[model samples]
Target: MTELGRFGVWVPHTEVTPAQAREIEELGYGALWLGASPGADLPGVAELLDATETLTVATSIVNVWATPAKQVAESFHRLESRYPGRFLLGIGAGHPEITSEYRKPYDVLVEYLDELDAAGVPRERRALAALGPRVLKLAAERTAGPLPYLVTPDHTREARPLIGPNALLAVEHKVVLDADPVRARQTARPRVEFYLDLTNYVTTLRRLGFADADLAKPGSDRLYDGLVAHGSAESVVKQLVRHIDAGADHVALQILDDDSLSTLRALAPLLREIP
Candidate 1:
């Protein structure tokens, strides 16, 4: 299996053009994770793969509730045939608040995995957007591993044991490159606020030792700081390294701003220092 490199970047698919995709590859990012709930036909993924050589493209999540399992599997086969080892199929059972039919998510995910298995979407090339232990263990047993979002190093430390030693632990960390504490928090609070409405995220944050006060609307400074690394590129690298040290195989850095191409370009030299 081709390992996901130590560092990668996660950006919304709609925000990334083929030119920017190529720029990401040129900047030395090993993987480009598309943060889209792309149903069935993931043309954006194909577009990205076509734009760059040796750069892996993965769906941050293709929600199972919105897209049929067989359709997703078919899309995976189509991409894998053309892109070969460069496509990773990441599937998830999204939050209940947004999904009308979000009952028994664990069972639904397992059934979806079953469909993918039947359709010959290689297990090694698939990943799960998991946060809790049950789903994380399922990710280890059924697919490549869990691609946990909005997680801290402590979560990574705890998750490593449940997923065991072999499965890939790809964790997403948010970053803001600003030295001023007030400005950095200003950039981070809105991003954190977006996740607060979702029950899954709130539950996960609580599990990570955040109190009810911390998970409040606008969120506490402690909550925001824990979830996002804000400072110089070097400071962002330190937070990312914490996850790696906590047993994460891959850390997908998400820059909390509109202009990610410039952010990735600026952080490239500092990120390359990680082995």
Candidate 2:
């Protein structure tokens, strides 16, 4: 397995400039997870990797519906050959509502993994963006385990036993650096509301024990608290660490702020204390 350190930074591909990638590495984050389904060609990924000496750059996922498995495999091979143990491929079947071509997602994902396997993309070098029990099992069986997004620490605890002990359980967590609770939740709500519209996330949240009320748009306070780590840096770090304590090998922090670097910079020293 590639060294994902203990913590990673998760952001949209557009947010990570090459200079910022270097800074993230310097700040001691072990990996950089590109979210919002960076495509198979992985535009600008090379530059980010080039800028950072050691940071492991991974996709939160390359959408299976959008990119063919063969193309994704070829891109993975290209990066792996150049970077060796530095790149991790994360693949997912995007939502049905958003993708017209989305159908039989589980079967499609399995077939996609088959293609990658035939293309020689090592199982350990890739991960699945899984949420449901079935897909989680597939992730455990076929690849580097689940990189579930919009999840709580409780979900992490529940998922670990399902994925088993050896698989790399990397969970993506949203965070707000503000010390003020109201301000923090306000900052997190838009992003949280956005995911509320995604059925997969809402279903997972429901399974996690939230009712429809909690799943409602703008989200309940409980849902907001569960989904986003907020308040002081120390407080947020404590919340983020709960995912690790629950079973996550790595927690990808998606700082919900206009200036994400400020939050990353603040959290750097506190992160060193985490094992």
Candidate 3:
């Protein structure tokens, strides 16, 4: 919790049981990030914190549409009171296609942060789910740094500057531990295709070196490979280091293959020696 040892896991609220949460903590991960589409319940941050003593429980984002700012603030206060300094609130500007009332996303998030601040949610405890410069900049100035999703090391490089040096610029990167380039790409492409259709993600990827064709259906091999980390254990470790070298304070690793327990166990011997 010293703003270091920052590797973490991105999990759905329900996918993680208390037992799994305990295992992740024992694995040496510093935080557990929760992500869900719109209307997904928060899985109760208190439960995650209660289940584990040291590991941080973060929401990759709780959609602003389904959950109101005031309610989120209340939850923040309640959880922080029970377990001080162990919860990080991450909120986002959800996709335009998903919500008809999703107008003025930038303004909405700015206003939301304003409300959160007014409600006494300190800057340190909250973060924005930003994938663009304007929002990323706001994240730096308003609260914690940007939590940019589905990004590459190149994107991490671009975002670090936007968030500046002091803010926590946490980014999520996907990985598939398959040596065959085609097999790895195949495993990772579906994971990225749906995100590509969203203009926010599309633009961010283009910034990181993806082309129009690359963003097409199934995603071009170039886009797929660049966006997702794939290959042997050595190559995967290098890719993670690439993000940290590029300027990430922490990199949340979501290994794309099944057997998450085994992949996580495999990383222990490696992460322990990384520093």
Candidate 4:
């Protein structure tokens, strides 16, 4: 009733199973957010939903290039009717360089929302995969909230106001269980580097107090530490709490470890301490 405490895990579409999803639920994370990078998210979501009893599944993003909003809205409505509140359609205007169809992002998203509206996609049932300010504001106005990727508490603080009080704000952060600082940062660097190349993330990270120097290739160690939680479970807990205190309604974790279940298990004791 209180929105299941607002913690979730992000997984690649094919990697999750009902059994593993049960573990996530058992570990106290409320929702299971599926990354729609290279697959059909709706069908993948069906698999994830079928795997767990009450774990809500949202697309970390359903790419605008791959799926049309009207069709997605129709499909979303069908799923909402079938599953009720257990599904959240988080759609995004992905990068321009990655897709030939990319245009003005805000314009595209605005049009997409308009299409969804015509198709009867209720605003409250969806969220936006947003990072930039204009999109974040639009997301606040049009959907449930903003799901910001690779953001820190500072970005959350800035976004909290843009979204006002009623809209939900979920910021995603990376995490690793290794204790050695160097090893921890190293594990996070490779993944973080790619996002650094993407302007939206770089802009958000810059707004969050990171310098361009810190956002450079391989990512500065300090920047990596700020962006991703590493080392002891206690340390990771503190990072997540920072987000919660910074006006975030939810913090979706993208665990850097290979064994996601084991990572959850490691964080279980600390996760309970989040609120």
Candidate 3 accuracy as TM-score: 0.95
TM-score of each: 0.98, 0.98, 0.95, 0.94
Best by lDDT: 2
| Residues 1-275 of candidate 2: C-alpha lDDT, one tens digit per residue | 88899999999988789999999999999999998888879888889999989999999989999989999888988898788899999999989889987789999999999999999999999999999899999999999889999999999999999999999999999999888888889999878898888888888999999999998888898998998999889999999999999999999999998889999999999998897
What TM-score does prediction 1 earn?
0.98
State residue 159's C-alpha deviation in candidate 3, in Å. 1.7
The most accurate candidate by TM-score is 2
lDDT of each: 0.88, 0.92, 0.80, 0.81
What tens digits encode model 3's per-residue C-alpha lDDT throughout 1-275?
A: 22426588887666677778888999898888887742333556677788998988888888887788888888888888898988888899889978888888998898888889899989888888988889989988988778888888888888888788888888888888888999888787667778877888887778777788888887888777777777887788888878888888888877677777788787766776666
Model 2 clash pairs are none
Q: How many residue pairs clash in all the candidates, one count each?
A: 0, 0, 0, 0
Residue 200 lDDT in candidate 2:
88
Ranking by TM-score: 2, 1, 3, 4
Better of 2 and 4 by TM-score: 2
Looking at model 4, residue 239 earns an lDDT score of: 82
For candidate 1, the 10 contiguous residues with the lowest summed lDDT are 257-266
